[model samples]
Target chain A: MSTPLLYALTGAVLWGIGLMGLIGLRHLLRKLLALNLIGSATFLILVGLAQHHNGPDPVPQALVLTGIVVSIAATALGVVLIRRYFHLTGRTELESEVPEAGRDEEGHSG
Target chain B: MSNWLMAGLLFTPLALATVSLLLGFRQGRALSWLGMLLQLLVSVGLWWLVRHEGGFYYTLAGWDAPLGIELRVDGLVVTFLLLTTLVASGCGIHAGFYLEPDRPWQRYFWPLYWFLWAGLNTVWMGGDLFNLYVGLELITLSAVGLVALGGQAEALRAALRYLLAALLGSLAYLLGVALVYGQFGTLSLADVAGQVRVSEHALLMRPALVLMLVGLALKTALFPLHGWLPPAHGIAKSPVSALLSALVVKASFYIAARVWLEAGVAVASQWMAQLLGVLGAVAIIWGSWLALCQPRLKQVVAYSSVAQIGYLFLLFPLTFGVEASVSLHAQQGITLQVISHALAKAAMFLAAGNLILAVGSNRVEALAGVSHFLPFSLFSFGLAGVSLMGLPPSGGFAAKWMLLQASMASGQWWWIMVLAGGGLLSAAYVFRIYKASFLERDEQDHFYHPDRRLEVAAMLLALASLGVGVSGSQVLSVMAMPFEEVQ
Candidate 1:
């Protein structure tokens, strides 16, 4: 396979793995890391595609640059939120969702 | 002149947000209010310009497409711009009173709120795919921050969940945009639409559309993927909840509609349309059922949003399933639904927030003495609830009327049943609130006297929701849909 094709495949695999981790992981920090992994996978695929042309595509480069910045901001904010969540309650996982049939099923008192 | 106004439509909020951030709350709140009022004027100016001179596309910084970004002003954009201006202004005014200006929170809230407004305007006006990704990020981040402003543990946890889920959605959307750009060699919506119409790179485009649509669905909180919505929208402060419910979700959904109707309509098939309708149907029934079960007032409204959003999905089927002539009607119907929902939902949240503030609790049972104490706000809530229930002389009723007509005309009788059932279910929850509020209490519970200005602001929005129904016919004419008009 060509270099771009291989990189694209690897990126796709990383995305799949990251998504699986995001869904499967119960730890808040792990979930945030999984989300970052997905972001990296997307950026990698974008960079790979940018090289598909004879020279690097400027548009995708600009997009990736901006994407990296946005992803950083999002990750930073997420970390702050998780830190506070941990500070408030020592747990990392979200309050385990009760079954749909559980008692809080009705209007809950705040 | 209009071009400059168009640019102002995009940048004024950005400038105001920066100014507010630096100036702090004392000066920031006044400037934010002025910025919103200015946006209202600019939005109307753009709407009039689009209506009179027809929609136009301008390249940012004099750069052409496939290179520089584009800002598009069209019927869809105009309609949404108007919604953003009106609902945002109302929410801002309510928030001004909702949070005491003296509190340090104002320093934080005003800046983020304006940033969110700026982001919403970008979503509506951005013609380039990358710009939209940026816009969605702005909305998501600002919205998550707003949800966590109260600093409670529950609020923080919910914000974290929302941040993760929303980021995942954005990444997925970005991946789709990347794939589309790689295949089509362009990122502008118009350019992409042209490419997709000729079925160029049909293979790549299909997956791209799937990724984008699925991501948007998650962000929009449709059906099963909506696990993050109730918590995020419920735990936030009242004005924050109102903004999130009223406008934040709609930004992503607007992009979805723009893609489906404008760019990828040809690639989208009958089954895909039907699939959206089915998911919507389930969201309606499931959301309403959950809303009925909610013990707190805010949760009921939040779940009701999930159900109300289902009504919007039905538009996908109604638009693409039928003939071209029939699709126009469906298009108008869905647009009406969007606007009316914004008005009614914003009004409901503001009023509910007012009631909750006065009663010092969100439990429905705690609202017994509220009607007696804050009758005006309660009256506002009732009017807003009337619209929510799709009762007569309200925006929600008008939207439902149009959707009903479109479904009938398109012969999609199944959706008709869903609409009817959803409305009745909405009535059940709305009525539940009404019933609780009307109950005669044994002991007199003291209610906090809400700010008079805040109550008036809430009343104004509720009345506007009712007024929109009276002028419902103008909706189709005002939107002036380019695609349907051409047909």
Candidate 2:
């Protein structure tokens, strides 16, 4: 198989595995990691495709570059939110127990 | 004049935001307000120009499409641009009173807010796929930074989760673009639209469409891919939450819609559109159910966003059936719905922020008798809810009306059921908050009187949501102008 086709197949497999991991994993952090793997797979596919005909397509490469930067920024923000949640409740999974309505035990009443 | 105004409108916020970063926390608040005021003035000026002179296109570095970036200001772009600037400015104004004056994070918020403004405008004006991707990155990065701006441990965690999802989404989009470029050798959306031939590479095209749609779905936080949204949106300070929900997610969806209409719809399978519509329907119901169950006020609003976004996705299946007037109506309805939702949701988040400030808590139950403490905020919340609930004399009502008509006309009454059911669910949750706010509590309320300026800003947004209903015809006319040929 040609390199682009090989890359596309690998990307498809990685995406499938990553999605499976996302579905199976309960921990938010783990799910995020799975997502990242899927993202990396996608980048590989894009870069491979852009290399078609022995010449790189600047357009797709440019887009991938932009996408990479965006992904990092979003990852930074997501980490911050995860940290906040962990501090507040001491767990990574979404809090199942809804806080009672009338209390400010969390000290965030304001 | 128009071209320069467009550039200024897009870049001035970034310039001001950058300057604020250098100034640090001491002068951040003042700088933020100044930046906001400048953005508002520029947006208004651009809106007027678009109104009077029709849309204008600006090619960066004097290079045209297929080579350099192109920013085209159409009715849709102008409307969204106006919305972003308005919401950002309002949030800026509101943040002044909402955030502690001495908070160290103020230094970061102002510059990021402006960067976000510049990104939003660029995304709105972007004429091609690559340009759109650039705008998307700018938006994603700035938004991620904003989420982490809170700097609390939980906030950091949530920001990380959001970051991963965004990255994955961007990657998927990039892959799709690469596939298209390999097949067609063009980056310009218009060029791709003209060049794409379905028969030559059906298999390749299908996967590309799937990748692009899935990526956008994740970014838009469509039902199953919505893991990052609730915590990220809910935990962020109210102003940031408003922008993230009201504008940022919509930017991705806007691009997806444009791409689908311009390229994918013509060459892709009808089943794909139907599949998207199905997902949207699922999201509407699932999101509403989840929102109804949330304990926190902000979480409730965040979940509602998932449901509302589903309605926007329904436009995909409805837009492709050229012979069907019902599909056309559905398209129009979805367009109107998008605008109305943006306005209403922004207002709702702002009002929720004010209530949280007043009650000194984010918990919904603790808001007993909050209406008495902050009557205006409550009033604004309720009014915005009117739109969310699709009640009469509200833009939400007009949007739903069109949607219902389209459903009936198209005989796609299953979607009608979803729309109606979603509305009921929305009403249920809204009323839950309304009931909680009005409960008679005898204790003296310890109100954290939010800055009057912020309250006014929130109310102004709420009023704007209501005003959309009055100006529905005008807005629809504008949305209708683009894709007239397609219709």
Candidate 3:
């Protein structure tokens, strides 16, 4: 129908795909990426939808903008954690492969 | 003056948090406690005023909704405000002892803690979708920072996963708001509800709902989307974990419930409600089973959170189609469950933190002689567990009873079974901890001694859970007052 509605549908489909990827993937980084993708899709949909209500709904757009900034901050934090996990246990998956003593020194297993 | 009060209530902690960043690692503990004390006082004063006045609403900069921001102070918001402040106070005091004075990361923890507090308060007071989004982001950023504050390898890793999940959730919620805004041209909850027209665009509305619900579900850690929680919560410091579990997760659920109610979406297919109930049932069963299996004491508590979240989800089916008296009862039950869980879970985590400090290990099996060393902490832990198990004279029991009645009255027999099963599972995990704590030991081994002050804080919260149970009728009356006009 409307262009804004079309964009919203596209964003929704992308989000669905991202969620599926997140569930299907085993790699921690891949899961994070999928989550990021899904987040972007949601933002796109929201911004697109806001376009139809008026010339531009600053409130929803502002909210989504805030969401993007926060998402980036969260992603940065996640990346740092991933790096540390790789350094400590030499693995990214949460499930443990190391011995109990090794895990104690590194701080966690799962 | 009202606008100033509302603004102060929301921004003061945030300002303090940012200022603490300048003070850095050296005075982190001192500043944290100072900030927390101020927050506690403000929250208490606000609670008293709201209780006396019934409720209050502030239009930001004297601008009305659909044009400018609005912050509403009601019984529900005040109740949550009280819980957040109490937990922050306890955590602040306990952290002073829990953290080593010379630790490098203490600098970051204080600011983030306050920032989280600010975000939490904003969520409680926020009256519209856009304001909620801002609140949620502030919360997400600060919470992620706290997770990473541990600075250890696992803490960093857990923080990363947590951040990713939180971002995804925010995105979905943002998208939903955009759709609602495009259709209705308003971000205020009441405005959106009044102008909502879902007839012409079934295709658009369905997807929007799905995105928002899925996003929030991820943030709330409702069963299937809960992959990030155990690791993130378990690896963080004890006080941080306590705050995250007890208060942070509840924020997303509160927003979701608010949207669902305010949107007045014609109770989307019965299947959706059933699906949510089914997932909730699974979470209750699965979370308990996982908690029972965890060797680490903190992991056990973390997994227990998964099960506890299930009880919150049970509200969906029980409250569906509920109107008038039944709606009032459901609302009361849900609010009680939320408040009771916050108190009990925070106490449980604090007690567990004490035990871990005393025993010098997080392993449950190694806690054989902890009761001898930390008797007060253990006692409080048991009290909290009683609430968790939904036993008589506890708030958990009251919440469960109300939900059970709602289900029966609605002819939803299946949900009754789910509730009973969840309660039994809750009892099993709680008793597991109790059994561990009480096991008789041959040799008395002296481990590290925890500070008496922390023990007192944990015990106080545990007692609050019991108090909520005893005063259930009064608390429900307060929670019901604001909603009466809506009905």
Candidate 4:
């Protein structure tokens, strides 16, 4: 198999593994990490895919560059929100909170 | 002048947002009204230009074709563009009262609100794939930030969940784009569609199409993947919820539909479209069931949003499966559904927000004595509910009628059952509010009156939905502009 195809497959596998972790891991931090892994995998695939179309394609390169920036911004937002969630509830996993109303103890503490 | 409208649509909000962020609260509040007014004019002008002058496409700088970015405006784009502008402007006005003009948080609110508007407009008018990815990120980030503005533990947690969902959705969408670029070697939708029209590249097409569709489905909050919507939309401050339910989610749906319509239709098989329709059917049933069970008023509205979105997905199969005229009617029906929902849902959220603030509780049971204080909000809520329930002389009914007719004409009676059942289910939830609002409670003694201006702001959108219901032919005509061109 070609190097580019191998790299592309690796990226896909990483995405699968990351998705499993995102779903199975209840910790908000771990979920965030899993999300970032998916990002890294997608980016790697973008780079690998750039190889398929004769020589270097600037479009996929440009796309990867933008994707990286977007991923970083999303990661930053996730971190900030995760920090707030931890500080408030003292827990990393999100409890569905469907019936958790009438309680603002954590909110008041902050 | 018309060309400038497109650029103005993009840059004006962005420029105002940046300036307001630097200037802080007082100046930002003062400038946001002007910013909204400017947006309204530009959006209306864009619709008119596309209506009379035909499609408008603007490329970045002088570079053309596969090399540079492009922004295209057509009737389809304009329909959503106008909806975004109107609801956004209305929400901006309401935010003034909701956040109070003098509060420090409103400072954070204005810039992010404008950024969200800019992001949505970019998505609506985006002609190319790469630009859309960037806009999706902008939208997800800004919207997540807005959700956290509530700052309570619940709101903050909801914001985190929202951030994760949107980020993952967009990244997955980007992966698809990478494959699509690798296949077509072009980023522009027009160019990609043109390539796919002649090239039977299912090897490249199927994976790219499924990846993109699933990604967008997650973002659009279609059922099964819609776990985060209720919390995110419910916990945010009213204006943010209004924006999220009314327009933000629609942005991703618009992209998915555009891709499915313009490019994916040729490549995607018949069953794929049918599967999407089935998903819509399930979302309708599932979402309505949950909405009926939710204790909180906003959560019901949010889940109802999920149900209403299900109706839009019905367009995919119905459009591709039937006679040309049937397809035309389905398109018009779905467009009407999209617009009316934007107006009605935003109005409902604004009114619900007022109700929640006045009562100091979001529970439906707490709506007792609500009508005594915010009569206009209560009245407006009913009017919006009329549209949501697809009742007579409302936009929802008009859309539903067309859909019903199309379904009958096409002989697809299964969707007709789904449509009628969804409407009945919607009525059940909407009536729950009315029933609770009319209840007499001693809490009426301490009720806080919602602002007169905010009441009027919410009322205006409800009234607009009613107006569209009666005079939908023009909207249909304008929507046809894009349809005819596509043909």
Regions more than 4 Å wrong, model 2: A10-40, A51-110, B197-202, B322-328, B480-487
Tens digits of lDDT, candidate 1, B366-420? 8886777888988888888888778898988888888888888888888888888
True contacts kept of 1: 0.66
The Cα RMSD of model 4 versus the native structure comes to 3.5
Isolated chain B TM-score per model: 0.96, 0.94, 0.95, 0.96
Interface RMSD to the true structure, each candidate:
3.9, 7.0, 5.8, 5.1
Q: Sort candidate 1 into its docking category.
A: acceptable
Model 4, CA-based lDDT: 0.84
lDDT of 3 by residue, A1-110 (tens): 98877987898799888978765676678877887888788778777777864476576666666677767776776677777778877887655442321121112321
Per-residue accuracy of model 4 over B332-438 as CA lDDT, tens digit each: 89889999999999999999988888888889999997777788899989999999889989999999999899888988899989988999999999988999988
- Model 2, range A1-110, lDDT digits (tens) per residue? 88878887898799788877665676767767777777677777777765776676565566567667656655565565666677777887643343422111111211
Task: Tell me each candidate's RMSD, in Å, in order.
Answer: 3.2, 4.9, 3.8, 3.5
Candidate 3 global TM-score = 0.90
- Candidate with the larger DockQ of 3 and 4: 4
* TM-score-best of 3 and 4: 4
Where is model 3 more than 4 Å wrong at Cα? A9-39, A53-61, A83-110, B24-26, B197-203, B264-267, B482-487
Supply fnat for every model shown.
0.66, 0.51, 0.62, 0.63
TM-score head-to-head 1 vs 2, winner = 1
